[model samples]
Target: MADYQQIFQVSRNQAIKDVKEGVFELSRSAVIFYPKEGSFDCVARPWLTEAGSRSARGIWEIEFNHKLLRYIYGLTNQFTTYSLRDCGSLRNPRTIRLYESLAQFKSSGLWVTTHAWLNDRFLLPESQQKNLAELKRSFLDPALKQINEKTPLLAKYSIDDSGKFLFSIIDKQNPV
Candidate 1:
C-alpha cells in the first residue's frame, strides 16, 4: 500500500516488515489507560484471523475483529481523533501515544495524571519508570517537544504538588 510510502515515508522493504510486525503484534494483549476516564484491558484471542501478508504489496490480508471495527468506527463512542499527517511524521512512538492521550482531553484542554499511570500506558522502560528525573529527561521532555512542534496542539506540562503530570493541551487551530 502507498500508505507506507506516503504516510510513513518509509522504504518499500521497511514497509513490508512493518506491515508484518503490526499484524502479528495485535494478538498481544495490552492495558491502556484513558486520560479522561477509564482503562482498557484487551486480553482476548487474536484480534485478526490468519493475518497473512504479501511482501510485494506490503499488505496484510486478515479478518478483523468485529469489536475492534465497531470501536474504531465510532459505534462505541469511545474513541479519539488526531491528525494522521502529524502522527505519520512524528519521530518518537511515545510522542504519538502522548498526542492521542492528550487528544482525548482536548475539549477541556487539560489532563492531570500520575507518572505511574503514564508508565502503565506507555509501557516505558522499567528504569525510566522508577526514576522521575530520568522519565522526564528521557521520555517526557522529548515527547512533549515533538508534540508541540509537530501537532496543532500546543502542550505544556508540569509536575503538580501530588507529583502527577498536569498537562495543558491547547488547540492552536482555535485561538483563545
Candidate 2:
C-alpha cells in the first residue's frame, strides 16, 4: 500500500479547518474527504505552481476521482454542488469560481477537477452512511478541531479513484 505523507502540521490543520468552515451551510450528513492516518493517496500540497504547468498550483485547484464524489453523495444524500463565479450553475465556470474550495481539497483558487489524483481510491457504501445530526455532532466539528489540534495551515485537494471530477477548495487569500 502507498502512503501520502501528512504534509506539514500547519498545512494539515488549515486543510481541516477549511473543510469545517466551508460546509456549514450544508446539512450535517454531507460527507467531505478525510485524510486517513496513513494512506498512499492523492495527498494535498499547497498550490504552488505558476500559470500553465499541469502540476502548477498557482491556478489554485484541487482534484479528486469520480468515486469519491459518489461516496460523499452516498453519505450525505446530496451531491456537492458549485457556484460558478456566482452564477449559480454547476456548468458555468465563472459562477462556480464565486465559491470557496472545500477544505478537504486544499487548493484555494479554482473550483476544479483533475485526472492525476484519481488513480488511488477509497469508498463508502450507502448503508454505511451517517445521519446529518450525527455527522454534525461527531465528524464535522471535530474535523476542525483535528486541524487546530495539529497546526493551522491545513489544506488539500479532492479526487475520486477514477481520476474524474469531484471538487476542490480555494485559497483563503483569494476568495472566489
Candidate 3:
C-alpha cells in the first residue's frame, strides 16, 4: 500500500481505491486484434482475471487471463517500449495509449490502420465511429496536437483512398 502510494504519488485511500478498482478495471478489459486476413477479431477475454483481494488478510492477488499464458511465459514476436517521461506530459489517457501504439511502429515511421481497428483500439462510441469528423475532432486531432507539442515524435495523419487512417511518425531525435 505504501509502495503503491509512493510509486503513483497517490494518497493512501487513493492507492487502496486504485488497487481495488483501477488495477482490476484495466485487467477486465478485452484485447482487439486485426488479423492479416483483413478481418477484425475481438477477444472478449480480458488479460487479467479477478482474484479478489481481502484487505484484512493482508494480501492482494490477481491471476492472468488464460489467453495471455503464452505471452506471459515470454514467447513473443513484438516488443514495445515507451518513455514514461514523454507519457507524463500528456493529459488524456487515450492520447497516451495512442502514443504508445504509434511507438510500436516508430521504426517504420508509418502506421496505416482501418476504421474497424480504431473502433476497437479506442473502444470509441458508435456515434464517433459512424462519424469520421467527430472522431477527428474528439480524438485524433487533439491527441496529435499534444504529441507534436510535447514529444520528440512529430505526427501527421491523413485518411487515404482506402479509407484507412495513415499516420507518419517521425522522431526528431532520429528522423527515419
lDDT of 2 at 11: 58
Model 3: per-residue Cα lDDT over 83-134, one tens digit each? 6555556768888889988888888999999889999988999888899999
TM-score of each: 0.68, 0.22, 0.60
Candidate 2, overall lDDT? Answer: 0.34
Give the CA lDDT, 0 to 100, for residue 176 in model 1: 60
* Superior by lDDT: candidate 2 or candidate 3: 3
- Report the Cα lDDT for residue 13, model 2: 41
Please report the TM-score between candidate 1 and the true structure: 0.68
Mark the regions of model 2 whose C-alpha exceeds 4 Å error after superposition: 1-104, 109-130, 154-176
TM-score of 3: 0.60
Residue range with the least summed lDDT across 10 consecutive positions in model 2: 1-10
lDDT of 1 at 19: 72
**Candidate numbers sorted by TM-score from highest down:** 1, 3, 2
The C-alpha lDDT values of all candidates are 0.78, 0.34, 0.80
> Relative to the unseen true structure, what is the Cα RMSD of model 3?
6.9
| Better by TM-score, candidate 3 or 1 | 1
| RMSD each, Å | 6.4, 19.7, 6.9
Q: Please, what are the lDDT tens digits per residue for candidate 2 over residues 68-90?
A: 55554575644434222222122
Candidate 2 or 3, higher TM-score?
3
User: lDDT tens string, model 1, 1-176?
Assistant: 67767788888777777777777787564334344544644344446655676666566788766656655566447767665775677877788888889988978988999988998999989888899989989988988888888788888899988797899988888846
